[model samples]
Target: MKISDSFKSAIVEAICLLYILLFVYASVSKIIDFENFQVQLGQSPLLSAFAVPVSLGIPILELIIAFILLFPKFRYIGLMSSFGLMVMFTAYIFIMLYFSPFIPCSCGGILEKMSWNMHLVFNILLLMMAVCALLFFDKKSFFLRTKQFTVRLLLCTMISSVLIIILIFTFSEKIIHNENPFLRRYPPHPAEFSNAVRLKFNSYYLSGFADGRIYLGNYTTPAQIISFNSNLKDRKVHKIIFDPANTRFKVISWYVKGNYFYLLDGSIHKIFRGDIKTWKIDTELKDFPFFTRAIPIDSTTLVFRTNKGKKMTNTIGKFTNEQQVKVKYFEGLLQAQNEGVFDTDGVLMYSEELNKIVYLYYYRNGFVVADKNGKVENRGNTIDTIKHVNLKVSVLKNGTEYAISSPSITVNSSSTVYKNILFVRSQVKGRLENDQLWEKSFIIDVYDFRKNIYLYSFPIYHSSPAKKFSSFLATRTHIYALLGSDLVVYEIKNDLKKEMNSK
Candidate 1:
């Protein structure tokens, strides 16, 4: 049966009208919610690096193609263009489905409601319609040829489009991780919520982890300590029995490692040692210098941070209490951006497994790794883009004290190291992240410091609206967070463990 020319023309016109409606509606919807569309693009695993230009360019291109479809002479060209656009969209969905770390939400407008699988199916149907429309147009048109030739051409277009998307995916990942443009890639379920237990007070800070138990120290009650099993099932409170007879201790910090615990009071230059089993102070070491921060290296040595010389610049030093106090300062480990004290203030963590001391800057996106002897190993940057510290300081009263004059941005809030993994609680929100999620939880970024690569990030949801994440400790399989009066635990999923083990 031969189809009439008018019927064929009507069929082609109908398809063209459908495409015009689709493109115009999609383009207008994106334009109406331009900011949202851009944010969605920024979250795309394959298009994040090109989000700015792609977000602006895509809608304009769609509108132009829709206009072209309305003209009779350019109808064929419009159908071809629609076919190519649909091919790219389908290929993008395909890559996102198979290759992306996690799938983001669909594009704006009606498509936003569709699941990724449904969106892929819809794109494929539209793509087939484009091919049909081109075939039904005037048979003499160059686009119409032998059926086999047309199939081959369409297949080539699909393959080429897929390859292009794959290339973009590879390049975007490199840019997003290394030279990030403030975008974050969130892999699904890097850390899963396990359980939480509420504490008596909110002053508990993570002291240490040993013998499969999480230890916490209370700031308000300096000598009090709390210990919990890995699953938060078993909880116990212990106190350090020390006699404060003639010693004037201003601040006391407890550090537990292996089978011994150390009582350090840098303010009065005193060190107390005790056995973890007895929890009693048995010995007081002499020849210790006045310092601000200290971590136990062993039974005899300590890693301390103190003000150096008259400048009071923050410096790291190794202290040994064998016969005499031997202090060795690593002056170059910390680089200051503003006032040496405030700008260089950060979290000091020592990884016993790696034998590396990690100093994570509070206001910046960099960290320094050093060996036990204060030899610098690697200076690595976080996924954030803030290189310099944004701080404003004021000289107080007698010019001896310095205080922050304005609110400063904190990049990495708290961190802990377990074996080869470094877990950092990041304060700054990345591009395309949910504001509600940020309000309700703390984002923990995981990095393999041994490999010097970011593994993934996950959220530790707040136990209560009033409680904020203060400090955390990481073990081989669990991350214990101290949020106000609550101690929340998150189980490390196998996906993260595989990455850590692979390295």
Candidate 2:
């Protein structure tokens, strides 16, 4: 038996009414909580770069479709638009479920309460209703054979909608990581706080990790070394047996690698090497080039950064102390934007497993990866957009002493490198991120050094309001951070662990 024309018309009208209610409710809810909707979009892996425009466009477009569905003359067009939109929504959910690095909640109204799988089913049902309504509605005036032409058009619309989403997904990831517009993609629980230990003073810095223990050096007492076990439960204090009989040591730092620890005083051009078991300075080296920073690659080789040439520009070099000291400089490793001294200043990290040294610029967005012998390998950028240093330098009355005249913007504050991953503490804030979260925690951005791409970012929350992370070190299993007078440890979650294990 064939259905009556009146019955088909009634069916189409009922479906259109359902669509009108859904769109109107969703659009209004999005408008009511507009900031939250935009933030959800900013965290989306597929739409982060286009968050601002898409957040505003989606709700307005929904309202327009709802208004069109109210009129009989335009009901066919509205149904077609609704069908296309539902197809797009279904495709988005599928991609978010399978392909996206992290899923973000962006649905409006009561639909926000639905799981992604449930939302997928809901969109599919709405899509089927749209198709049925289109077939039953009056489309005879628009085409010669209404049913056949409508089916073809619907197929084309579905393909076009899916393609658009795919294109957006492809380009948005590239733009979000490389040409970022200050939008941060924060996945859930990339790192978790495990335990913390408080020190007596705030003058401690993370020296290094060696033999499954975390070592910290005190700035006030340079000879003292505080060590903690992997769990941060067992603590031991060891002092370096050194005597500064006649040498004036203005600054001193400790570095532990493998089985030996080195006490370096760049101001006095001295380096003392001691065995970890005895903590005795058995060897002392003098008359070395002045260096502001140093990291040991092995027992005999050390990479150092120092000012070179007549302009006092910063340069990185490696020296080998076998029978004599042999130094090699990679002058092009650091690029200067303004004053080379401050502009080129950054954190230096070395991965013993990968044999790669990374120089992360404090005032810029990128870092340079080089080999152990000072060979430039790959230059990778962080997710931020700051490419140049925001610094102002002035010469004092003496004309010889220079000082930073203005508060400079720091991009990558502190960093550490494990086997294949580089973890950087970012200082700049991104779009749609909560200000309160920034005030309460420090943001850590992770990158894959092997692929030269950003992996993800997470927050290391502060224990108290007055305490902030001063320095941090990353091991294979955990991250050790120095927050004010406290030493904190965080366990790496599986989401970050997978990226770290990737090539």
Candidate 3:
């Protein structure tokens, strides 16, 4: 249908008036709630680096465009500017939906009530209006000389594309790294807790993993090793039989490797070796060094941590009966604070695949890696920022340790090493809202032991609000955690599993 020039002008005027009203309302609303607008922009995936300037400039530009559209003399230029701005907004929305790590909160005012999908539709409609206004205002600008308008639109799109690419390249690491603003990388229902069973005692802890089964050792019942299949089915308790008349020693520590288990009594300095298949002690070696913490490397060699008598200096060393290899390898590994005996205590883990020993401090945001001989290899930082043990300890006259102040734990609470990945349960919270998230769930920070870099973190929901996951064992497909007296198994998310396998 052929339309009159006067009717086309009227339609163009109405579109211009609508845009003016929209921009004016939006700009005024942003100015009234400027702080909130700026904060929301700071959380944006692409514009976080220039959040301050963008937050201040967007409203000003909107107001200027609205005023320009109100004047008939500059209406064409105003419509051109509106088309360009709407194109940029629409492109941003499209990229956010497709490429962004996560979507942030909405902009303030009326837009805040709309979802991102709805906002994208609204932007597209406004863009169509701008294009219609531009076409009606021009006669030769569209049909005869298609070259002019097409070139301008293409140029605007190219400019916006370049800007988005640069922002993504520059700020993606800021969003993915430990100091990230976005936290919802995985789904809320990513894992399902199953096969929860009550343990015989709260002191029954995960001793080792071997032969596709988990071994639970109790402190009270040291001779009993409870084994469960990977799926928490087929429970079997193996009782190690020893000759009673040979020697009497309390089992202070127990560990299991491929097909053998070791029981060490640090008080009597005796080591007992037994076959895991037969569950019988065959060899008893005496004159072993006293170690507070120990783990087996082979049937003949062991890695242990012992405290030196003077000044409570603790050191890590290896022990072998071949030539009495009781040499301290990690001397002065602990930084002495007020007291060094218990303040620098940490969990030790040995990875057979990497052949590296990892020492994760309970109070700090760092871990040390060394070879089997205790030679220092590399030291890496955890995601947290704490470096020192925040504790107050005093040594009494009788050489007993006393805590004057209860310390606040701010770093690695629990950690386990498997293959090339180190999974640490963090007590510290990263860049996330909801202060109660820490209380409601356990946050796991994953790191690459081979490359020494933090990969990612995920939340594991707790069955109860007050209960925290004390320890967890990671299998190929699931993670079994000892929560209070019950065991909760959670299947690892497929994406996380792929991430671990890829690295």
The model with the greatest TM-score is 2
Regions of model 1 farther than 4 Å from truth: 1-11, 141-156, 283-285, 321-325, 394-401, 405-407, 450-456, 463-465
Displacement of residue 215 (Cα, Å) in model 3 is 1.5
Compute each candidate's TM-score over C-alphas: 0.88, 0.94, 0.77
Error of 3 at 439 (Å): 3.7
Clashing pairs in 3: none
Task: Please provide, for model 3 over 1-503, each residue's C-alpha lDDT reduced to its tens digit, 9 standing for 90 to 100.
Answer: 99887888988999999999999999999999887687666556666645667788889999999999988878877887887777777777877787765566788788889988999999989978877777677564334435366457647754775586556536754544534433323223334565777884678778777898888888888868898887787899999887746566665556778888888766667678888899898876656677777887888777878777566556777777665545455675555654776566788788776788888888877788888877777777786667777876666677744544666585778888777778888877654334566677887777776677666566777778756477887766677888777777777664557655563
Off by over 4 Å in 2: 139-145, 396-400
Top lDDT model? 2
In angstroms, give how far residue 262 of model 2 lies from its true place. 1.0
CA lDDT, every model vs. true structure:
0.83, 0.86, 0.73
Count of backbone clashes, every candidate in sequence = 0, 0, 0
Q: Decide which is better by lDDT, 1 or 3.
A: 1
Model 1 Cα lDDT, one tens digit per residue, 17-129:
99999999999999999888887888787898888888998999999999999998888778878888888898898888987777776797999899989999999888878
**Candidates arranged by lDDT, highest first:** 2, 1, 3
Clash-forming residue pairs, model 2: none
Predictions: Cα RMSD each: 3.1, 2.0, 5.2
Worst 10 residues of 3 by lDDT: 181-190
